[model samples]
Each structure stands twice: as structure tokens, then as C-alpha cells.
Target: MVAALLPRERLLMGPGPSTVPNRILRALAAPTLGHLDPQYIGYMDETCELMRQVFQTTNQLTFPVSGTGMAGMETILVNLIEPGDEVIVMINGVFGGRMKDNMERCGATVHAVEIPWGQSFTLDQIRQAVADHPQAVMLGIVHAETSTGAFQDLSGIGELLHQQGMLFAVDAVTSMGGHDLQVDAWGIDAIYSGTQKCLSCPPGLSPVSFSPLALEKIESRTTKSRSWYLDVSMLKNYYTGGGGRAYHHTAPINMVYALREALAIVVEEGLQPRFERHREMHQLLRSGLEELGLEYIPDHSLHTLNCVAVPDGVDEAAIRKRLLNEFDIEIGGGLGVFAGKAWRIGLMGESASEKNVLTMLAALKKCLGD
Candidate 1:
């Protein structure tokens, strides 16, 4: 006979899948409802409104996509970019690289502007890129580069893009609730994020928003979007309300419940306070790590995710293993070029607390034999 499945709880201090709060878990366990049920539709509308509150945008088209963060990325690209459309992508880290790849897969002519992994692009570089690629219809960038813990500033870039007659798209997968993101104020035409990172929700849904300009661009696309499932035109009808609501696919009922609950938590805490909490936790962890002779990697690091350099002669993988085994704590190692050379410590959402920071520091000290 098959045994009943059970999983041990571990503090998630990794790059993602931040530790889910009990309230959110309970929300996930709520009874599932039919996708087209009127109650579920009401819940969906509430979720969209909550997303707007968190995103700080009045965008009517904001809603959660059915897949993870990457799905949100694809949805934005495939809808706005058609075959042979020129698009400029800023690539500084893994997620930025993924954006470039996604644009290419959409058959768009991509102009990729790259900087070092740990550094962010300046406004001058952005201006130069626009000058170099005048024909590009859209420019995509990662607001918080998760792989390298680098936070990109979107403050003035949005207005610049709009003035240049180019749409501004952003990947906020790791920054959404943890950082200050004003989608409307920043003039972001379109943006996408994941639930798992700073929302303190499970990995499944990707919340995305489209400005009126972005909607116009998507509507004006000469060719059909390559992805039928992620096509925003069909998605908007289902996500947006009114008497005429069409079903694109079966939405993830329980995940929506969980996200609704998580977003409610965000709204209750308020965005500024939530962002300050994350910053405080990051500072606490930074002080502790620096005391242990570690240094940060990013020029402008994300408060939600911290990437620190590992000391020479230390077994990065072994320390991670010991933390998981002996301390029942989970943290992340570096990716790509920083693999085995850095540690990616996340203090996202519910996991961003003084208790978790102190616990991780103490556990790490033991694992490092200090």
C-alpha cells in the first residue's frame, strides 16, 4: 500500500518560494470552487483589485496568470512583440537574459544591451540604447534581478521610453511586494511578477498588469501571439469583468485563494511598511554576515534577496547541506557565474523577520565552525 505523503517544514531563506505564512496555507486549503462559479468570479475580481493595490496601479487589466513568473514574462513579450518587431532588452543578470531569450523566441529582432552581472544599468546607458536602437518598439528590463540580487531603478526610464515612442515593460518577479514599485507613476506600459517571492504565496500564479498604451500595442499586433494559452487578449476577457465574461481555461482555484489571502495580508500591512520590513531584515542579515567576513556582490542589492560572497576555501555546498540537515534551515547558493562563489539569501515577505535573520546567522555560524 502507498504511504500517506508528508513533508517536513523548513525555513525557506532561499532565492524564492519564501516561507508561506499559516494564514496563506489555510487559504490554500479552502474548498475548491468551479472556475465559472459566480462566487469564484467575485473572488477573482477582489484578487485583481488587491493586485492593483499592491502594484500601486489603477490598471484595469491587472490579474494573475496561470503559470509561474516565467509565464508572466512570456505573456508580456508574446502579446506586445510580433515577428520582426524590434525590441531592446537590458541584460544584467539571469532574468534579464531570460527576457532576451523570450523576445527572440517570439521572432522579434532583439537588441540586447548588457552590463556586468552584479551591476545595474544607468540612465545614460538606457538613453544610449534608445539612440542605438531607434526602431525598437519596446524595451524590457528586470526591476529586481533575482539571480544576482541587483535592483534596477525604473524611476525616470519609463517616461524616457514613452517619450521615445517605445513601450516600457518590466519584470518585477522578485520585487513586487518587497520593493516600492509604482507601475502607473513610473509609466511602465506592462509589468509581470510571481507570487512565490515577496507575496509569501505558493509558486503557481504570475500577477501581471497592462497600461492602456500596452493594451493598445497588444491590440495593434499585426500577427497572432505565438502562445494561445498566455495570450493576454483572451486572458483579459476572463480576468476583466462585465456581463460578457469568457472562459479561456480553468484557473487555478486553490492557488487563487492563496494569492487572494496573501495579497490581503500585503494590503493590510501596507506597501511602504512591508518594504521597510524587508529592508530592515536585509540590514540585520547583512550586519550578521559581514561580522562573519562576508561581503555583498551587487552594486545595488535587493533588500528582498541578498547575494554575498563566500569566503575562500569554504565548501559552499557542504555548508548549505549542513544548514538544511542540522538546522532544518534552507538557504540558496549562487547561480551561473557566481555558483560556488556566493550565497543567495532571501528575506522575502513573511520570511523577512528579525527572528529568521538571527536564526539563519546563528545556524550559519555553527555550520562555518565559528
Candidate 2:
């Protein structure tokens, strides 16, 4: 006979699904309501407003897509991309490669500007890409690459693309709720972010937003989006405010509850303070690692996610295993090119705490026999 489900509490210091707070978990346990129930609909509206505040945008199209971060990416791509369109994809790490794949699947002719996985792209490289791909209608960039912990600066890139009449898309899956993401100020036309990272929520819903320019392009698309489930044109009808509702799909009722509460907590704490907390925790971890003779993978890394080189002569997987089994802690091994050669540590949401950082340092010292 199958036993009851009981999962141990492991301190999540990995890339995502960061430590969820008890308040958010309790919100998820609240009785499931009909997807379109008035109370639930009100909750959805509030969540959208909260998302706008978190993203620093006044875009009315902001709402949580009922899936993981990848779904949000596909939603933006399928709604904006069609056959024969030229899109410049900036590939600095695994998530950027995923964007390329998504673009190709949408029948977009992709022009990729790639750099070393652990570094941000140079301005010259970006300029060259746009100059070479003169017909490109869109530029896709990953803001926080969890795989490499490299942070891309969209501060000026948005204005650069806007001047050329190109739509700007961003994957903030790992940066949202943790980093300083200014969707409007950065001129990001279409952006997607996950709640699991810095929102102190379990992985499920992905918050997405589209600027007016992006919505105009979607409205002008001649062909249907390849993905019916992720079609923003269809989703907008149900998600946009003060509209007659059309049932698209049954919303992830409980996940919405969790996200609503999580976003509320973020609002209570304020964005600047949350971002500062993540940065300070990252600094604490960085200093601790440096004292242990460890080096960061990237010269400029993300405050929410940190990548560090695995010590030579040490078994990387074994170390992670020990960190898990012996210390009841959880961290991540690297991905793609850096796999088995590095570790991906996350200081996200509730996990980005001074106590957590100190505990991780103490545990690692013990495991490393220091």
C-alpha cells in the first residue's frame, strides 16, 4: 500500500524553487475555488496588479501564465513570432539556447550573438548583431542566466532596439522578484519571469507582461500562434482587466492562490529592500566562498544566483551529494558547458537570508574538512 506523502525540509540553495514561506504555503491550502468565481477572479485581478508593481510596469496586459518559466517564454515567442521574421537571440548560457530553440520552432529566422557562457555580451557585439541583421524585428535576451550566473544589462539595449523599430523580449525567469527589473524603464516590450525564484513561492505560475507595442504586433500577426495553449492573443481576453471573460483553460487555481499571497508578501516587504537583501546575502556567500579559496564563475554574477568553480581534485557531484545527504541542504550542480565543473548557488526570496548563508558556509567548511 502506498504511504502518505511527507517530504523532508531541505534548505533550497539551488537555482530555483527557493524556500517558500509558511504564509504562501497556507494560502495554497485555502479551499480551491471555481476558476471564474467572483472571489477568485478578484484575486486574479489583485495578482495582476501586484505583478505590475513587481515588474515596475504599468502595462495592463500583465498576468501570471499558468505554467513554469519556459511556458512564459513560449507564450511571448509564439504570440510575437511568425514565419520569415528575423529575430536576434543573445545566447550567453543554457536559457538563451532555449530561446533560440523556441524561436526556431516558431519558424523565425534566428541570428544568434553568442559570448562565453560566464560573461555578458559586449556592446560592440550587440551592435554588430543588429547591424548585420538589419531585417530583424525582435531581439531576445536572457536577463539572469541561472546556468552561468551572468547578468545581462538591458538598461540601454531596449532603447537601442526601439530606435530601430525592433521589439525587445526578455527572459527574467530567474531575476524577477529578486533583482531590479524595470520592464517599462528598460523598454522591454515583452518579458517573462517565474515565481519560484525570488518570489518565495513554489514553482508553478509564470508572470508575463507585454507593452503596447508588443500587443500591437500580436494583433497584427497574420498567422495563428503554433501553440494554442500559450497564445497571448487568446489569453489576453481572459486576463486583461474590465473585459468580458471567455474561458480559455481552467486556471491553476491553487497556484494562483500561492502566487497571490507570495506577491502580497513582496509588496509588504517592498521591492528595493527585497533586492538589497538578495544582494547582501550574495555578498555574504561570496565572501565566505572566497575565504574558502573558491572563485566565482563569472566576474559579474547575479545577486539571486551565484555560480562558483568546483575546487580542483574534488568530486563536484560527490560534494553536492554530501551537502544534501549529510547536511540536509540542497544546492545545484552546473548546467551545459559548466556541468560537473561548477556549482550554482541561489540566494533567492526567503532563501536569501543571513542565517542561511552562514549555515551553508559552516556546513561546507565541515564537508571540506576545514
Candidate 3:
């Protein structure tokens, strides 16, 4: 028989699933409530409200999907896109590539605009893509590319797309609470994010929001969404129907409690201050890494997730293993083209702290034999 499981605690400074605060852990341990329980409904409503505040949008379709961030991505794509529909996707990193894959799987005609892995798309590039693909229904991009630490600007792109009569979708999995995202002001038609990154919650739920225009497109779709589990029309009935809530699936009771607590923590600290904290911590980490003769990968780096180039002749895998086994600090390795050449050190949510920054710098210095 297996004994009671005991996992060693490590400081999580990785690409995602940042350190969960003790308060959130306590919330996760709260008594399990029925999926349709009146009390749980109250908590559910409050969670949606908190998510809207964090997303800075009044989208009525905003709620936490009962899966990871990828689920949220699929939810938006499948619901908004039908077979043969034209969509333009910006591919600068792994997540953007995944978006293109998902869009293709949805039977949509995807026009992938490729760029270098560690770079971001300029507004002119996006305009060119839109100009070339005049029939596209939506344009998707990643606000924070976790794999490469590229931060894409959404400032004028929304208005540009709106003028072209196209929907704007964003993958905000790594930027939700760590950066300043104005969904309404930016005119993002559809957006998806995870609770694990800047929210400091465990990896289970995905927070998503869809604008009225996106919902209108979904409503006007000729075919049903390929994914029944991710169909927003059905989900809206359960999350924000007219009368009594209809049972969809067994909601993740403890996880919702944890998300509520996490969002509450974010609200208490205030979004602007929290964003500033991540920026300051990233600068602190960047200065230390630069002193150690390291370089960054992205031209426009993300404050939440930092991807830095590893030094030549150093065994990156060995250093990562040593940091995990000896120092009990968990950082992430790179993905795609950056594999074996870069390290992704995340300053996300509760993990973004002065203490953690100093600790990581000291551990890495020792690992590098300096």
C-alpha cells in the first residue's frame, strides 16, 4: 500500500503554475459544495465578477472555464470559428503556433503570419496581413508568449481590426494579472487566460472573456462548435442564463474557491501596483542575469516570464538538474527553437518577489561556479 504522499516543497520560478499563496491553499481546502448549490452559485457569481475586474471588461460572457488555459483557447476558437472561415494568426512562439493548430483543427482556413521566435509582430505587419487576407473573420495573437517571453502590444491593433470588420482574439495566459491588459479599452473580441500564472492559483481553471461582438459572431455561426465541452453558447446558459442555473458539468468546487481567493488577493493589492511589482522584479532579475553575462531572447520581453540565453559551453540541463536537486528551486527550460539554448525564469504572481529574485540569482551563480 502506498503511504501518505509527501512531496518536497520547492520555490516555483518556472514558465507557469507559479507559487500558490497559503491563503489560496486554505481556500482550496474548504468544504466541497455541490455544483448547483445555492451557496456555491453565490461564490461562482462573485468569482465571475472578480474576473471581470481583473480583465478590466464588462463582457457578460466572462467566466472561468473548468480546464487549463489551453481549454480556454479552444473554447474561444471553436465557438467563434466554423469550418471554411478565414482567420489570421500571428506565429512568433509556441503558443501562437498552437493557436494556429487549434484553428486548423476547427476546420477554419488559417493564414499563419510567421515571424522570428523571439520577436513580436509590429502593427504594420498585422495591417499587411489583414490587407492581404481581406476575407478573414478574426485575427489572433498572443499578448504574452510564455515560450519566448515576447510581449505583443495590442494598443491600436484592436481598432485596426475593428475597422476591417474582423474579430480580435488574444491569448493572455501569461499576462492576465502580471501586465496591464485593457480588454474593453483595447477592444479585444475574445480572450483567454489561466489562473496559474499571475493569479498565483494552482493549475486547474482558465479565466476567459468574450466581447459582445465576439458573442454576436458566435450566435451567427452556421454550424455548431466542434467541441461540445467548450461550446460557449451552452456554457453561457450555465454561467449566465436568464433564470435558475442549469447543470452543465460538475464544477470544480475547491478549485473555484481557490480562484476566488486568488482574485480577491489581486483585487486587494490593486492591479496597477501588482503589475508594477512584476516589472520591478523582472528588472531585478534581468540586472542580475546581465551581470552574470547572460542575454535575453526576446526583443520585447515579458515581465511575468523572462527567457534568457544560456552561456556557451555550460551544460544547461545539468545546471537545471542541480538547481532542482540541490537548491530546490524550479525554473523552466526553453521550448521549440530555443530548446537547449535558453532558460525561462518566471516572475509571476506570488513567485515575483525580491527574496525569490535574490535567491534565484545566488543559486544560479553558485550553479555557474561563481
Query: Any runs in candidate 3 off by more than 4 Å, and if so which?
Result: none
Each model's C-alpha lDDT? 0.94, 0.92, 0.95
Per-residue lDDT tens digits for candidate 2, residues 83-125, read: 9899999999999999999999999999998888999987677
The whole-model C-alpha lDDT of candidate 3 against the native structure comes to 0.95
For candidate 1, write residues 36-150 as lDDT tens digits.
Answer: 9999999999999999999999999999999999999999999999999999999998988999989999999999999999999999999999999988999999999999999
Worst lDDT 10-window in candidate 2? 237-246
Order of quality (lDDT): 3, 1, 2
What's the CA error at residue 350 for candidate 1, in Å? 0.4
RMSD of each: 0.9, 1.0, 0.8
Q: CA lDDT of 109 in candidate 3?
A: 95
Scanning candidate 3 in windows of ten residues, the lowest lDDT window is 241-250
User: What RMSD value applies to candidate 3?
Assistant: 0.8
